[model samples]
Target: MLVYSDDYLEVIHRPASSSCILVTFNEMEMQANGSRFWGQRFCEKADFAALGFISRRPNWFPAASIEKAAAATAAILRQASERILYGHSQGGYAALRYRLLLNADVAIAFCPQLSIDPAAVPFDGRFTRHFAPALHADMEIMPEHAAGRAYVFYDPFHAVDRMHAEWIAEKQRETRLLPVHMTGHGTVRAFAGTARGLALIESCRADDVPGLRALARSVRTGAAMRPYQVALTAIARHPAWADRLSARFGNGFSSVERVNFLYHRANRHIRDGELATARDLLVEAMALQPNNLGPARRLQELDARIVRTSRT
Candidate 1:
């Protein structure tokens, strides 16, 4: 049911008889101005009250109406015996930001950024445009003040993400930094790719950190994780493993996986000065996922470069 809607936010609430509540935030989608209730389809089988917040823009937990919403969320959470906050990427940031405000018992954040302010994280340029208006916002305090536990999942090899995780760990003693190697910034994808995401979520709800760790390790070694590792290896400029992986597995990849593999290969070819090969791989990627603007934009750039080279 719709709980709140304004120019800045849209909230949806699904009530259940269970004593537990799962509060979630939505991730930013390409070209989309607003967000939706994330994880509804996945959590349909579970017996918990679900509350999701959707931002109307690519704004962080906007300070404008967060307090009002937090009060309402806290009121709901007070009725439940247990509460968990869950999100990934931009939403992950929100889960952490509001965890203490809602008095959530547990928070599971996948690749969350602690702060986008240049004063705090001047090195990260990935979200410079989004960070511009939020610079003056106070980021000194986080969910660290809460007595509840927080689990942060991120790829240690992802330099920027690693930096953010490390900073968060240093600031918050209640938070645990779990390193998911070679999973890239999309750590949640790594969990879902292997079908172990729900298991991890359940484990976190049970407050079983060891079980969560063991489950994560098992997923890392499973067949489903191979495609993700292969993509990461190729993106890191080592395509030999990607070739070996494809040869062994054959054409068993999903469309999204195929598109990512092709894009990575295109990047490798471009670095090797094989523009034609890069162009062909990118074309294949575009064919697999035509609506994806990332490859579409990159393909246009490649076309312009090829035309310039031909004229010369």
Candidate 2:
């Protein structure tokens, strides 16, 4: 049921008689299409009602500005017996922020932005599009003043996400930081693709921290997690590693993942000043995933550089 809808956000409630409720938030810069959104689909079969929040923008609710929507959401959550929150990226921030307000039991945030305010995260510019709104909003502190425990999932090697997680842990004593290395900022998708996402969610729902930790470690070591392997190759920037990973893993990556693999390998070649190799890799990337614009744009840039160098 659509509980509240406004220009800024939409809150939908899927009521079940179960004792638990899962409150979800949408990622930054993503359009939430009714119940078909990512978080909704992910927790669909769980034995809990779902309260999904679809943000039209990346303002992080701007609590002072959207009092009506916030109040409505609070009312809905306050009625629930046991509430657990789930989200990825910007939605992760919401899952943490409102956990205390709603008195939720647990929060599972994947690669969450603790704060986008320049004052809080002065070095992070990943969300420059929402800077003005974030500045005006209550982006002063990490949402650590909550009652229930929060589990934060992020890649330790990912600079921005690591920084956010570290800061959140530093500020919030009850937070458990899980490092899912090589998954980059898309840990949710990486785990989902591996079919262990539901199990992890269930662990969180049960408040089984040990089980969750074991599952997360399996995500790092599991050979069936093709996307994680592909991401590792991309981060490693080695063509041979990509080839070996592809050979061992077979064609397990999505179309976009394939493009990323090629593009990153191409980028490595470019850095090495192997223009022809980089161009060839980008061409293959475009051929494999023709609709992906990253390789196309990189290809154009490579061609322009080649032309300029030839003229000189």
Candidate 3:
């Protein structure tokens, strides 16, 4: 069963019978479709022999409505084999919450935020509207009960990316943190060329992210990876260079080019689920740049949250 809305909220059902279900929130933002849009899109694309042809939209409810969006997913998965969840932005946050609802096979979030509360450390306003309620700290931050495989990707420049990265860093799982230098929040595009990493993520198996390995090797040696600015510029002209550079500089602070770096570093720690390290990094960054109230306020809020959780 699938539901529809004027916005792009939709569900495409298939009898594939894979326990793993993919639920993307406000994926492309849908337009007003008075008729069967998917069928037409499928027909047109399939006619052209386009396997990549899928529906797209440009409108959705605010991010606050993310939790409610999962209702559609929960209903569809009432009968399934295994469940793997994937989403970005509010979709990502909602997937995390919904993962708690089932024995999730894998939960993949591109760049999910922490919360929507005013007191919370925000990613950015535009992102928030799209990801609404999922980012809220009051959100259900559940322990991994399903198969427990999760991948969270973040970009420092984007607010949602920063928040998501921080959350992962503090999550304290034996997670494989993949850091892309100067990569924005949309990683599917960034990692499109990553066959090995893509295969690992899709299959829930890791052999070699030729990307991660080279970075570790360079760190083992004494090589300075490329800078984010240079990498970003090169990516616009030649995406291949970006891919090569991203693999080399997972957590090199030497290229601390923006305010977002603090969050990225903290998030890298969180990816390994070392919340303490993340917290400390947030604090130090906030102290060093007191002019920016976001980090300072967020550090205090997170510390209080940790304390409260510890007491509980």
Backbone clashes in candidate 2 total: 0
lDDT tens string, model 2, 131-173?
6753356664354556688899988877889998888878765
Extract clashing residue pairs from model 1. none
Q: CA shift at 103, candidate 3, in angstroms?
A: 3.6
TM-score (C-alpha, index-matched) for candidate 1: 0.78
Model 2's lDDT to the true fold?
0.74
Model 2 stretches astray by more than 4 angstroms: 28-30, 33-38, 41-44, 57-59, 64-67, 117-124, 134-136, 140-145, 190-202, 205-207, 220-239, 247-250, 286-293, 308-312
Rank candidates by lDDT, best first: 2, 1, 3
Worst 10 residues of 1 by lDDT: 27-36
lDDT by candidate, in order shown: 0.74, 0.74, 0.48
**Regions of model 1 farther than 4 Å from truth:** 30-36, 129-136, 139-147, 189-202, 223-225, 235-237, 246-259, 273-276, 283-312
- How many Å off is the CA of 104 in candidate 1? 2.0
Span of ten consecutive residues with least summed lDDT in model 3: 46-55
Candidate 3: count of backbone clashes, pairs at least 3 residues apart or interchain: 27
After TM-score superposition, the amount by which residue 259's alpha carbon in candidate 2 deviates from its true location, in angstroms, is 2.0
